[model samples]
Target: MDTLNSKKVTRRSFLKGAALLASIAVVPAAITSKDASAAAKATQAAMQYQDHPKGKLECSNCIQYIPGKTAKAKGTCKVVEGAISPQGYCLAYAPKA
Candidate 1:
């Protein structure tokens, strides 16, 4: 009886561990898929910054723009990577509504 009980416990533990690993593997794939989708959208939008802006359009007024932590400094954009300037203009620009 004792031997049978121990074997059942071992199998249950193994199954639990396998289930945990499977869940961990699935979470990253979901996150990666979301990131890939965002990248695709950015590409479709033709996201790019211009040194000389086309008009009054700038990162500061774009919906994707994220203001810098401090004043008078470059900020960031949701679609564009790297440090972005508030005065910078990009093809992905969408007016803040």
Candidate 2:
């Protein structure tokens, strides 16, 4: 009978492997999630980002708007620099699904 057990995984080794995989999975997600907001934001003037709505269009309703602490509070935009009004409109606006 052969008793060579070279592949045995100890608790410490198992935990290390699990933690390595967990970190591998988490890092990609963190990087991807930031892809949208990490890019250099466009100047508000360049995007025609206004403090008021453009008819029915507005920042809160756009996909690029990052909400503030409150419903009506000013927020930031993924595509524009500086604080943004919830009612603001921009040329870069894309309706959220």
Candidate that scores best on TM-score: 1
Off by over 4 Å in 2: 1-39
For model 1, name the residue pairs that clash.
none
Tens-place lDDT per residue, model 2, 14-75, is 99999999999998899887886666789989998889999999999999999999999999
- The number of the candidate with the highest lDDT is 2
The lDDT per prediction is: 0.78, 0.90
Each prediction's RMSD over C-alphas, in Å, is 4.5, 5.7
Model 2 quality (TM-score): 0.60
Residue 1 of candidate 1: its Cα lDDT? 86
